[model samples]
Every structure is written in structure tokens, then in C-alpha cells.
Target: MTQEILRAEGLRKSFPGVQALDGVDLTLRPGEVHVLLGENGAGKSTLIKMLSGAHHPDEGRVLLDGQPVDIRDARTAQRLGIATIYQEFNLVPQLTVAENLALGRPPRRFGFVDTRAMRRQAAELLARVGVDVDPATPIAGLGIARMQMVEIAKALALNARILIMDEPTAVLTTGEVDRLFAIVRQLRDAGVAVVFITHHLEEIAEIGDRVTVLRDGRSVAEVAADTPQNELIRLMVGRPIDQQFPRRPAEVGEALLTVRGLSRRGAFDDVSFEVRAGEVVGVAGLVGAGRTEVARAVFGADRYDSGQVSVRGETLARADVHAAMRAGLGLVPEDRKGQGLVLGDDVAANLGLVTLRRATRAGFVDLRAQRRAAAKVAEQLAIRMTGLDQEVRTLSGGNQQKVVIGKWLVAEAGVLILDEPTRGIDVGAKVEIYQLINALTDSGRAVLMISSDLPEILGMSDRILVMARGRLVGELPAAQATQDAVMELAVTDVEASRVQ
Candidate 1:
């Protein structure tokens, strides 16, 4: 029997109105990939935070190699060979790769920083992860996949015996994910214990060795990595979900959003599309294919080189977000935490964001009316929050997303652009979001959905627009669309050349 590397027993954590984690247990063995499976708010975050020293467990103990240890802070965790790579990269964007790798504790010789030694160490670390990025390049210059590699390299810098990766493949392309998995396998072979957390069930069978399912802050079951997807979904959500993407697309109506010659010089070009009322127009593409850029431009978040976005026959002014918002366009961005909601504010404030100015009465905003409006939207979306006064930051990712969508509803937006609507949400929350999409479309609203999730695109979209190298390559109706068809159109010429 293999000895355990790390263990958590009866771990519990709490916040103001929510019991973040009730009692959770996890075990990691050397040279094994231990997967943590859970919904967005199912105590996964709290558990990881406790392990990584970001939070203290209110009850229970963490054991490392048969000895209980108190992980006081991040430094202590690192010292104990525990490295956590969160979904958001922690690298300093302004610094070079080598500088970021040696950020806090650069090599010092006679009290002077040793730049040469730092770069050499960084190169070794990068090579260990099979990443070939130059040490001289700034962190900001690297793409997401490259940055992820750099993060892994940074983790390896600690000579990590236990690696905790949170949604590592969430933003990665297929090829990049393969590369990452290869590195993970190498690490596992080298006798490192890995804790892999992801919302994508498909990856579990491929990458994991053992699984611990967390539901409502409790560790319900520890099963094999090869567990069926439906069973895993059932365990995580504590219910059998009949449909993953329950999209009941409404009857098609007149065009509400029309984009003509939408082009941004380097991001995207020659993009033209229309999202009609009561339909979902899914934009499918690989990373850096410029789908998000086009969405941002359409919402007036960014300026396009030469193009016009029209809402109901009226052309919106260039680079004017207010005009776009007033013209009935609401954009639910991919980075919901950064762009979709103001995290520090309460639920009512975030829900009233789109209608703040309109909800004012004689130089005073209607706080009472705003709360009422937020309460109604929250109830409509079934947002599980204590009250409207609760901070948006404390709510789960799914509830936060509903608040983002609810604000637009409060504003009465006719066209809602959802970018990766169910990105980090669980199966149950995803179904809820899909039903909301149906309701929105049934009420004669237009939805322009952009997603990297191929199955989601196929299942929920009425029409799919495939983008490659910043251009619209092909379009497929739901009747003719499959993952293969979508990929065939979305694959870049570089992939074709490589395949040949």
C-alpha cells in the first residue's frame, strides 16, 4: 500500500451567512493524481484555500506524511512542498519571465541581485515543464497557454511534492491541454502527489487516478477516476440532471443586433453577423481566434477599426458603451469577477448596476425600489443568497453570474451577449442558465452566445458561426452541427499543416 502524502480530516470553514465547508476529507498519495470534484460553491475553493494556507480550518486538522501540521500562510505551504496554481495566474505582468519566476526571492550575490543565475534557473524550470518560452519575454506578452506553463514552472520551482491545480485546463486549447497533461504525467511518474480540480468531467477519466466528490461542503464519496460522467455529475450536484444543456430555443423573430464589417485591426477582421430575436447565435472558435474581441467591439467596450454595430436599425456610435447599453445591448463578459460585477458591492447594488441612473428619483437613487427590484430578480433566478444586502463577492460563481444577467433584465435589454455563460458553473447551474436563456428568447430577446465549449455550442445554439484566424470561416445550423463539423471549421491552417 502506498503511503499518503497529505490528508485532511473533518475540515470545516465558515463565512458570515454561509457555511463554506462543513466537513470535508481528502487524501493524496505520492505519485498519484487525486481529483477534487465539486460544483462552483461546493466547498472546493474553501478546502483548497485551507490547504494552501489562505484560510484556517475552523475545525479538524491537515496531516502531511502522517504528521499534523498547521499551515499558517502561503509561505508555510510552499515551505511544506505544497504549491497551488489558481485559475487566475499570480505572475506579475510587467516583469520578464525570469523576473517573475524569481519575483520574491531573487538570487543574491554580495547583496546584489544575480540576474544571470536567475535566468539560468528560470530556463531550467521552464525546460522541466517542457515549455520553450524565452526568459526575456515579459509575462504580459505571453498567451494564456504559455502563461499556464510558466505557472507550472513556477510551482516546480518550489520542488513541489504536492501540486494543487485549480481548473488548469479551463482556458487551454486541446493541444495545450495535451501538453499540460504530459507534464502532469511526468510529475506523477517522478513521485509527486497531484490534486487536480476541474469542472470538465471528460478530463477526469483521462488525467486523474482517484476522485473525491464534494457536495454541499461535504465529501460524499471517493471513487475511481474512470467513474461515469453521469454518476460524477450526480455526486457533485446531489441530484440526477436529466439535461446538461437544456436549451429550448424559442421561435425565431426579426434581427435585433446587426454587425456590418466589424473589424479590429489586429484582433479580428471582416466580421459580420446578425443575432435575431428569440435565437442563440453561438460563436465557436479556438483561443486567440478573436471571438471575444468582436463581442467587446460590438458592445462598445473596445473600438473597431472599421465597422458599425446596429441595434434595431439604429447604428451605435463608435466606442460608446452608454450608447450601446441605451440601445438595448448587454454584454456578459467571460471574466465575470473582473468585468461583470463589482465584487465589493452588495447583490442589490450589482443587480441594479445597469439601471442605477434610471432608478433615481429627484437627485436621489431609490434604495428601497432598487432592493425590491434586486429581490425580484434574485428570486426569479433562484439565487441562493442570504439577502440582497450580502456582498456579491461572497456569493457562489453561478449566483454571481445570475446577478450579472439579472442586471441586464432589470435594464430591459433586447440583445444579451453571453460570453462563456456557463464557463465555471456546475451541471445543475448550467441547466438553470440554459433555461434562463430559453426564457429570455421566449420573451423575444436576442442572444449572441460565444463559447469554446463545443458541445454547449452544438446543444444550445440555433446557429453556429465558426471563426479561425480572426475571420468567420463557416456557419452551421443546429441540424447539421457536430463537434467534428465545428472543429473542422475552427481549426487553424497551422493545425492542418502540422497534421499533414
Candidate 2:
């Protein structure tokens, strides 16, 4: 029999009011990719947290190579050859690639920092992951793909036997993703056990060997990826879901938001688009196509070197988030934890963030009014929380996203820029968010959505714009949108084609 690299029997975890994991069982075979599937709040995150030592299992046991192991924390997990690469990287931007690669285990000589040796070691590690980057360069200078490669290299350097990758391709281009897959295949051939988690169905067909379904904190079933996509979706979602996006027809009104010749140096250039009230306009592209940058520039969070933005035909200045907000623009950023909310704060405080001025008297927060307003918004969003006073960190990924979105809905915006709004959440919450977006348009709000998810853009948007290398490559009406068409535009060079 093939060796079982890792095994979890009757694993369980519980919080104050939620049983995040109830008797979950997972088996990882050597040299195989085990894909975990679930909706948001299905306890998928909790199970991985226990595996990576971020959380202790309330019951049952974990065994590595047929021997029981106690993983108390992240450090202990790392020491035990279990390495996790989360959707969000844990690299220090200020440090050089070499320093980041050799962090905590840097080579030292005569009590002096050994920069030369560190760079050499970092270069070797990067090469192993198929990344050709200068180790001496600071991490902030690398693109998102290269940064992700650095993360993979860091894990490999620790001699990890079990690798956990969450949404690994969410921010990667086709070329970069192919290279990463090559590395993953290499690891699998070398007898490494990989636990893969993602929402993209095609990825499961491409890389997965065995699949396990989790629903509402319990293991539902396990199957081979060769099983029909519809069947897999049914198992993951716990029901038959036909074509994920269900968009409703909304009458388009006058142009509520407009951008002409929008340019942000080294980011997006000449991004021009218009959105009418009661319309959903989607910006689609491969990773690093400047979709998020365009959203930020239009929302006044980032400066545009040259551009023209108009709200109902009135010109507005760039690089002013507060001005944009006051002018009826709301932005739901891509990185929720970094740009969305204060995770340490309570739900009430987070919900009241944007409208705090109205709930404050002479610079002092009116606690009662803030709490009352937050409760109302929470109730409307259907956020599952014990109460308004609960900490934001305690909520699941879907609820946290709801809290971020609720902040915008509380203060109605004429134009809402939602970047990757349904990312990292489950299918159930995705449906809720879709309904919420529809409700926004029904209320005469224009939505500019940025997403790498092709099906989502095709389903939710009235029209779609595909970007490639900081330029808008092509435009497609929703009725004509297709995945292959978007991929063609996303990979082509727009400037070279114009010359042709």
C-alpha cells in the first residue's frame, strides 16, 4: 500500500457559538494532490488552520507518517514539515529577497550579517521554484507572481513534505501559473503531499488527483476529479447549482460615472470606461493587467498622472478618497484584511467607520448611535454574528466580506467599485452578494466590478472590458462574452496589434 503522508481522524473544532469543524476526516497520500472543496463557513478554513497549527483541534488527532504529532502553533507545524502558503503572502516588503528567504535562519559569520551567502542561497531557492529574480532586490519591487514564487521557495527551503496552497492562481498570469504548476508536479513526483483549495472548477480538473468535500463543518464526501464538474459542484455546494451567476435584467439609466484617458504611471494607462445607473460594468483581465489599479484610480484612492473623471458630467480630482466618498463613490478594495477593515476592532466599529462623522459629537464617538446603526446594517446584510460587539476577526471569511460591503451600502454611493467582491468566500455567500449587487442597481447605483473570475464577470455584468499589460485590449457585451474570447484578449499585446 502507498504511504499515507498525513492523516486526520474525527478532527473537530469549535468557537464560542459555532462548531467550525465537526468530526472531519482527511487523508493525504504521498505524491498526490488532495483538493478540499466547500462553501464559505463550511469549516474548510478551520480544518486547514488546524493542519497548519494556527488553531488546535478540539478533538481527535493528527498523524504524520503514521506517528501522532502535536502541532501547537505555526512554528511547530513548520518544524514538523507542514508548510502553508495562504492566499495572502506573509513576506516583509521592506526586506530584500535574500533576507526574506533566509529569515530567522540566516547564515551568520563572525557575528556579522552574511549578505553574500544569503543572496546565493536565495538565488538557488528561487531557481528551484523556476523563478529568475535577483535575490538582492527588495521584495516590494517584485510583481505579485514573483512574490508568490518567493513564498513557495521559502517553504521549500524549510524541507516541507506537506504543502498547503490556497487559491494559488488567483493572482497569476497564464505563463506564471503554468510554471507554478510545473513546480507543483515536480513536488508531487518527489513524494510531497499537497493540499489544494480553490473555487475555480477548471483548476480542479487540471491539477487535482483526489477531492474531498466539506459542508457546514463536516466532511461530506470524497471523489476523484474525473467525476463530472456538475456532480463536484453539487457535493461542494450541498445542492444542485446551475450556472453560478443569476443576473436580473436592469434598465440602464443615464451615465452616472465616466472616466476618460485615465493613466497611472507603471500601473494602468489610458483606462476609459463609462457606467450608467442600474448597470453592472465588469473589468476583466489576467493577473497584473491593472484592473485593480484602474479601480483604485477611479475611486480616488490612487493618483492618476493624466485622466478625466466625471460624475454625472461634473469633473472630479484624483487622489482624494474622502472627496470621492463625499461625492458618492464607494470602493470595496481587493485585499479585505489590508484595505477593507480593522480586523482587531468589533463589527459595530467597523460598520460605523465610513459614517462615523455622523455618529460623532465634537470629536467624541456616540457609542449608542454607532452600535444601533451597525446592528441595522448587520441585520440587513444577514451577517451571522453573536452580536454587534463581536470582534471582526472572529467572523468567517464570508462575514468579514459582508462587513466590508455593509460599510459601503450604509452610505449609498452613485458609483460603487467592487474589486474581487466574491473572492475567498463560499458559494452560498456568493449568491447573497450577487443579490446585493442587483439590489444596488435596482436602487439606481452604477457598479464597476473588477474580477479575474470569468464566469462571474460574464454572468453579473451588462458588459465586460478585458485588460492586458496596463491597457484595455477589447470590450464585449454580456451576451457575447465567452471564456476563450477573454483569454485571447488577456494574453495579446494591444500596442503591437494597433501597429499591425
Candidate 3:
């Protein structure tokens, strides 16, 4: 057997009110992809952070090559041939892609930055990742999917012996994910030990060599990569999810949000759709399919040319977010942290964000009512947090997502536009979000959900709208919307006269 590259023994970590990791043990071997599997709040993040030197464990130790080592910081870990790609990006948006790629260790020529060499090196990295981005483009200019690829490339620059990737495929398209998997396989063949973490269980069998399941801050089991997904789900979530989607079809009602001739030039073109009350209208598409653009146009987050957005028979002004909100339209954006909630504030404040305007009288906000409403919503969502005053930035990914949805719920939105609502969320939290969707539709509200997860689109959506190349190619009812059908439409050209 190959010798172990890294080992963790009885790792324990705690916060003010949370024991993040408790007696978690793990072993990694050279040239192996070790999947750190868990549901949200299952201590997976904490364990990885400890190994990456982002957080020090309260108890237990890490061994590298059978020698006890203190991973004091990220830099120390990197120097010791360990690298990590976190869920949250560690990139500078203002910098060019080439500059970001060569951030810390730029090649110098006689005390000057080697600009040409940097671009050349950046091109090679981008090619390795199968991304065709110009090295000169600013990080801010690229979409979230491209940004994620850049993160992977940046980590690859380290050429570390041990790599830790967290939710690396969350933002990628199906083709991009395949390319990433290929790169990972290459790295594994090159004798690099990879620690992979993802909420998507299918990826475990595809890319992982071994699996470590964490549940409630403890490592519950170590199993083979080819273990049945049902068993893996049971191990991580502690129960079988008989119904992954659990979408209860609601009676279709009148249209709540309508978009006609929505065009955003290069981003999206002539997109039109309507989400009706008491229905979950799912927008399914590949990456860059313009689903998000169309949703944003309807929500007035982005201006649309030659389009009309109407809510409850009232035509909304173009590029007016406040107008959309006043029309009872609430949008859960794709980049939740960047657009949804205020990270620096407390839970109560974030939950009250959408309603603060109405709650204010004579320039004085009603703090009492806000707190009461936040408390109710928090409890309703089962958001795990110590208190309402706790910073939203500190909560787990799943809890933070609930806060975003709670903000809209507190506003009593008649129509909710959810963009990738369960992007990085685990199976349990995903079901919770789906349950919330059912609750919304059951209460005579409308939901326009945009997602890349085809299974989710097929399972939850009452009616599916497929987009490709910035156009709505086809629509399917719940009974007829299979994954194959959606993909067929998703890959269809906009100019096609009829569905293939």
C-alpha cells in the first residue's frame, strides 16, 4: 500500500456556541482523491480549515509524512506543499487575470515585473483548465463560472503535493465540470493527493477514490468511492430522503410576473416568460444560457432593452429595482453574498432589509416589530444560529441562505425569483429550500427559479422553460419535463423553427 501523505487524529474545534469538529479523524494517501463528504453544518468546512491552516484545532494534531506538523497559517501550509481553494474567493477583482494568476510570486526582470512572462504563464494555466479567457481581462469582468476556474488555476500554480478544494464545481457548467475532473485526474496521476469537497454526491463516484463522511461534527464513516449513493446520503444526512425534490404541485393561477421581448444585447435576447401565482416556474439552461439575465431583467436588477415587465397588470419601469419590489417581486440573486444579504450586519437586520422601508415612520424604524418578525421567520426556517444579533457572515452556508429567503418572506413577496437557490447547499438544506418553495406556491405566491441542476429543475418545477443562447427554446409541463428533454431544448439553437 502507498504510504499516507497526511493524517489527522481526533481533531476538535469549537466556536462561541458551536463545536464545529469533534474527534474527526482522516487519512490521505498520495495520488488519491479523498472526498470529504457531509451535509451543511456537518463539520466538513471546519476540518478542511484546520488542515489548510486557516483555523487551529482546539485539540488533536495533523501529521504530514508521519511527522507532527504545526500548520500555522495558509502561507505556512502552502510552503509545506498544501493548498486550498475555499468556497469564498480570495481574489482581487480589480486585477487582470494574468496579474491575479501571478499575484504573490510574479517573475521579475532586474527589479521590474515581467508583464509578458506573466501573461504567457496565465495563458498556459487557463488552457490547462480549458477556459478561453483573455489574460488581460479584469477579474470583475468575468462571470462567476469563469471566476471559479481562475481560482482552480491559481491553486494549480502552487503545484502543491496536497490540494484541498471546497465546492469547486458549484458554479461550473456540466462541460466545465468534466474538464475540471480531467485536470484532477491528471493531478492524481502526477502523485498529488487531492481532498475534494462537494454537495453534489454524483461527483464522489466519478472523481473520488475514498470518502470520509462527517455528521454533526464527527467523522461517521470512511467508505469506498464507489459506495452506493443512497448509502452515502444516509451516512451524511443520517436519514434517507425518500423524495429528493418533494415538490407538491400547486394549482396554477393567474400570471404574477410577465416578461415580454426582454433583451439585454449580448447577454440575452428577446427573452419572454411569465411566472404565475400558485406555481413554480423553473428556468433551466446551461451556463451562459441567459436564464439569470432574463430573471434579473424581470426583477429590474439589470436594464433590458425593448422589453416590458409587468407585475399584477402594472408595467414596471426599466431598471427600477425598487419598482419591482413595490410590485411584490423579491429576487434571491445568484451570488447570494454579493447581492442578497448584508454580511456585516446581524440576522435581524438582514431579515428586515426588505421591509425596513415600510417599517419606518417619521424617519424612525420600528425596531421592535422588525425583531419580532425576524424571530418568527428565523424559527420558521429553522435557521441555526446562537441569536439574532449574531453576524450573518459567521453562519454556515445553509443558514446564511435561509436568511436570504427569510428577508423576502418577511416582505410578503407575491412573486419570488430564486437564482441558483441551492448552488452549494447540501441535500438536507436543499430539501428545506424546496419545502420553502412548496410553501410559497401553496400560499398563492409565484416562484421563478433558475437553476443548472437539471434534476432539480425537473423535480421541482411545475413548468420548465429551457433557454439556450439567450433565447427561450422550449417549455415543458412537470409530467413531460425529463432531464433528456430539458437538455435537448437547452442545446437547441434559438433559430430552430421547432423543438427537435
Give the alpha carbon lDDT tens digit for every residue of 1-500 in model 1: 89998889999998987898898889899999999988888999899989999999999999999999999999999999999998768899899999999988899999999999999999999987777888999998886667888888888788799999988887777777888899899899999999999888899999999999999999999999999999999998888899888889688989999999888888887889899999999999898898888998999999989988899999999999999999999999987887899999999999999999988889999989888888898899999889989999998888989999999988889999999888777778889999999999999999999987788899999999999988888899999999989898888584454468
Q: What lDDT score goes with residue 104 in model 3?
A: 89
lDDT of 1: 0.90
RMSD of each predicted structure: 2.5, 2.2, 1.5
Candidate 1 deviant stretches above 4 angstroms: 120-146, 494-500
Models ranked on lDDT: 3, 1, 2
Candidate 2 overall lDDT versus native: 0.87
Local error of candidate 2 at residue 454 (angstroms): 2.0
Task: Name the regions of candidate 3 deviating beyond 4 angstroms.
Answer: 495-500
Question: How many angstroms is residue 454 displaced in model 3 relative to the true structure, after the best TM-score fit?
Answer: 0.8
TM-score, every prediction: 0.95, 0.94, 0.98
Candidate 1, residue 159: lDDT: 75
Clashing pairs in 2: 40-426
